[model samples]
Target: MNLIKVKGKSENSFDYIHEKWIFKEIKESNEQKFKCKSYKSKFKCPAILQKISDEYKGDDSLHNHPHPVIRTRMEPVNKMKVPKTTRKITASKRITIKPTVPEKLKEFKNLVTAYQLIKSTFIAQVEADDGSCASILSTKYCFDLLGKAEEIYLHATYKIQLSDIKISQILIFFVRRNNIGIPCVFVLSDSTIKSLYAKIWENLILRIPSIKENLKRVVTDCYLPLTFAILEALPQTDVKGCWMNYIRMAARQWKSCNLVNMRHEVLKWSFLIPSLPPDQFKNAIMEINETIRDKKETYIEPVTEKFMSFIKRWWEPAATIISFSNSTNDSINISEYFDRHMGSEFGSLTPDIFQFSECIKRICDNSENTWKMMERGAQFELYEKQSFIKINNHISNNLELLSDGKISLEEYFKQAMTSDIHELILKILETRQYKNDVGRLDEFHKN
Candidate 1:
């Protein structure tokens, strides 16, 4: 699919042409051609119409419609948390400065930790031109080992090596789900079909021996060629989905869609079970599944007439928004990108923040900080002053439930160092607060 960037705004039409990902572009004043295509599709981008069709699918979660769900793994962080001082000492009385890490920072840390824990568990990072290169990820240390997702996972430049096979693989690891063989790694990407090499997977597996046996599912976005590659690499692994990337072509031209918001809660939880530990993880898993099942049992909610009109109000800007690649991957790029970029087209991360919270219970960062961000992005007048304060105090009172922001620092460590945590997982203990899957995890941990 092409996003042709045209200058002087001619017909104002958008269309995709051929296998190449062509986009129309126009030059700014005294600028050269704002060329949208790089001769042909680069190794990074996919083929033409396939990408376009997937992107246009109906993403109307609000109406409870069935749309493809987007999924991506965020990094994770460390433990020693700031406990709610048992004594009612004021902020001034506190000698040690307790930094309330923001939700963004917290999420960044979780992603870093997840990557490190997985890296250590998988040891798949490739060595770069520098011999000391620890991984394909441009990082010296996992971020949040210190603090902040950025600090824990240092961003680095990815200089492409022609000699190296560039295959991208999504590894899915799971703990015993009630001793069932439900756990599997769904390989989603490969070199031959989508330009991503399979050797990249080999290099990773060789680096981390533990992942050899435990690998279960390996799936990717609805990108066909990439999907085909996964089929080639590990025929056994269940190809789940990379729903977000594939939606471009799924349900375009529906006028508007509200499917994602309705199942946002479900999508949040179910997707997480694969990445967590046993029963405790299972507990959270079971809870969300139960909720979704219960919700499904009821009458499906349909979009109201008023909702459509409200949506059309903003339709004019929709094209401008999509053209900017605003909906692209962010759940992956927050800390991964250089200082210049924020990873996805949607620079506003409120949806993802809320989605992650609803899914995992708490981000590695404090619930308080996440709320602050929600307030700042109150463009829809969502975070009214009163609403903000209410959420803050509610989170403060139940900080333990807030993932890493427990009222008791000891509880946070107990949760982190408690039995069954792998070394790689613990490194990012601080970044993404490992929710005990609410009580479902407790049920497993208790038994």
Candidate 2:
């Protein structure tokens, strides 16, 4: 059998491609053996290859499928070279060098390699400067800022897109530096294609082992495409939905169902759904649906249907751990950061290519400065971190009370909306006491 060696899903393993049929190494096999790729399919293919001395043998006894067309897997193609920076070369003057296509590509590739070496990141793709598409540029800094971060945030800025330059969006990856979130990676894409995003993220995860191994969580908006892409690439990392996005989606659905009066309740449920224990989440959703149906409004059916549909799409199959549910205010902070810098500095919501480049440089410099500062032992008081921990602990404690049947779901919902959960807990106890006293007085009067 003629076998061609190809890269496997992992670094140590190898797959054999043979005349439209692929074979994967069988881990359980004692000998050097490979099973047909379709062995796990419903067809139950029984083809196998066993290594005999320096040669291999194939058995296609149960093979039934026709030959498949061979397609190349998406691999990182190094397209640019890191440019040699001299004392005379500065950030402003670096982009002015008009060079041949080959030279420009080489220079960019080298720069990307240098950036990857420093930033603890991997450059997935670098589009050539054909003037037809936007190119992703990388910087030359020396630090593993991303590796040290346990969580990262993903966001996109459309305000920097230049229509004339074919720049549709700029995707940014933010990692923490001394508790201060900073942009660790940037990708300038021609369009917001889901597959493109998935491919980029997949390549990044595959190329950088630290990010793949050590990254614990990622925060992103409730955009299904982006969320799915992140999960597809970083399967091990927890994907936390942005709080603002969660409220916006729930509110939008509420408006569509003509249930604006129930907006506060809907928002409260939106926060509560992902916070519930996984075993209780689906039932809670059902209970909420029944409660809405009990409202007896003319549009009650639509309200329940819309709410259920929203729950099915967004909340179902999502992890229900409260600590992983919301990204407190990272989304808003990043948006404000972009607005203050990109809006004021560029003086336009949409900047041209040159202005956008400068803005990216500014962002990179800010991130590098943050990394350096953190390395120098400069500390940033993370109010968000403190709040996150407090809120998580508070919710966990309340959830324990809920699970123990000590607090009713109604009271839980009400307290969930309160800013100070401890104060709400105290108020709940006071209300119960007052009601008990009133009941005793009424009973005594009746006697």
Candidate 3:
């Protein structure tokens, strides 16, 4: 007899054949059942007996389970039994994965790399000896690179852009005021109000950790929006108007009112205000009021009144906090640097937004480097002075020797000429003269 395995209808059930009988495991019954063509039953049907014993009867009952059908056993047939089989199981494949950096960290690294590249490029251009090369570098190529760098850096660091809706470029400046070095900037945007400025500042503070404690005062052009914004964001910090802008605005107002003669007076007043102590500010205002009262008959009366109103409104309130004696020269310095290195063509032509940003950044970097060099020059100046004093003493001693007849005039003159101090003094004078000429050049460019 051959036993054949057949698939079960359900997962747990299977079928096998033994000669003329077929047996199936009934999942619901939890027992094997058999069906045979010979209804008379050859052997005491082991499948049925097993099912009865397992499902309905006990072990002692099975010994007495020779019912009428099983008592009439005809014969028993011997068949080979097969062992149980199962589906083969295989091991799953292993997967290999490479490590990676977090997205934000990677982005920050990229931004830093881009910033260095942009800064290096600008420094190179600024240092270039060829006028045409420097000009070309600043015009379009450098501008575009700087724009890209700003985009990358600002987005990575602050998640903000200067090109965002209604936003112009952000003007940043670092200034030392009242023993406090504050790094502050203005975000120029469309129709800025106090509330808008406050929101922008809040966002900036949230993103820039350095700004939280370092910012002490804000200096601006007395724009209403900017004034309100600073007041709202940092109520404790002092807000002062740019003295230069104040004077310029006053001059413009004087011209607009047809009181051109008063323009010089306005300029003089602007210069005087910064030098006065806070306590004297009120006295100065009173004096101005008296002057206006005396000139009430002149055509300048209305203009003078307007100017006084401006002073009372903007300047008086800020007198105590105002530390800068002159209007900030940052903008002037940047403009001069650009004009000097880039030429009139680049300066005159209005660059695209990106190009303009690039220009500003390059100017800032160059200005910073210039300031650093000047700081070092100051130290050099001290050393030069010390050397000058020593050399002067030696020269005086030589002169005394020549006068006393202890040394020949020729010998004294030769010793004096041979002294290293002569060369040192010449170098010092030349440097001072060069610096003065440069200052004049800067003033010329500014005008």
Candidate 4:
């Protein structure tokens, strides 16, 4: 195993990387001991190492997920520097600077800042110099204090981090704690990987045993890595693809493949695919591709090819769309709520790690009061558009009817393709509310 020194989650902390697995220094010990970083996630990995003098020992058990491809480097945060002593600043206002990091890692230079403001709170943040990675966690107090539920939502919010490098996204896991959707874990990383996601889920499960014991289903976007991650972490738990996210991606690709001319017919199919049973989903998509291919216009071949590639790449997640959960409206509402509050606190511009951490801290700090209010019968409902709920219900009913043999596949498809979501199809065709999937289709195709 190639052992590499890497920056840990906080200042003065260090991690050892051996064969893509990261090990953190065990604290409060006279001897040098390291434990697998996966222990920090929802997965309980039994890997450990002990260094004695110049030798290392201990059972380094296998990790559950693959080796992650993240490069951790210490960078400077010029904005977080201590203000000079000229103004009337209190002792609490003064910041303490840590020792300088080594110069060898100049390429991946960035300081990681951590703040421990509220005690007994289930939140902590480690902001890297470039705002590339951070973590907001719910400690053991989460279960002891807040309400519990059997479902969790893993939502990824993008374009919220402060970094010169293009950051992918931040993952936020939510649950209907106290009858309101509250984020239980927030993990931001430089890249999205199945292992990272698996660890985060493991961490959540470790902290809140109910997640593993009682979690029935998990609803998330159609990110295959995350879907697989959830299953890897909690195999018994049912993972469902977010129907809204699936349709949104389809809409984006519909525009990208230049299917606007065929939107009137294709839009109905796009809305109908998710409503179909898993066995029929593939055929429906293939049928749409055939429809596009049969258009007979030479200009349509490129579009057909694009759609075909998309079908191949999206097969896994799309196949899981009709499973457990029907919609991610609650998760979307919570995400928008977080974004609205963050925007209100930090303005329209993207917030640096510090500000980002601060906003999360505020949310965590106020959650206690929110829970208290909920206990007193103050209903804090996740606001969702009624139209979406109606459409989802209609589709769900159609599925149930189809499964019960009350309706044939043709009848189900007829209702799904034409009647149930006619408004959305009409809107897409008339208003042209279409855009590319941020080149995701092409990127996935190349990969």
Instruction: Give the best candidate by TM-score.
Output: 4
Stretches of model 1 off by over 4 angstroms after superposition: 1-135, 138-195, 242-246, 252-447
Candidate 1: C-alpha lDDT = 0.28
lDDT by residue for model 4 (252-289), tens: 56667667654456555665666565677666677667
Q: Work out the TM-score per prediction.
A: 0.22, 0.55, 0.39, 0.56
**What is the full ranking by lDDT, best candidate first?**
4, 2, 3, 1
For model 2, residues 76-128, the per-residue Cα lDDT tens digits are: 45312334464238664654542222222223333443332322332445332
Cα error of candidate 4 at position 430, Å = 16
Estimate the lDDT of model 3: 0.38
Question: Total clashing residue pairs per candidate?
Answer: 86, 9, 0, 12
The C-alpha RMSD in Å for every predicted model, in order, reads 28.2, 22.2, 36.4, 19.1
Better of 1 and 4 by lDDT: 4
In candidate 3, position 15 carries an lDDT of 53
TM-score of 4: 0.56
lDDT of each: 0.28, 0.55, 0.38, 0.56
Q: What is the lDDT of residue 50 in candidate 3?
A: 32
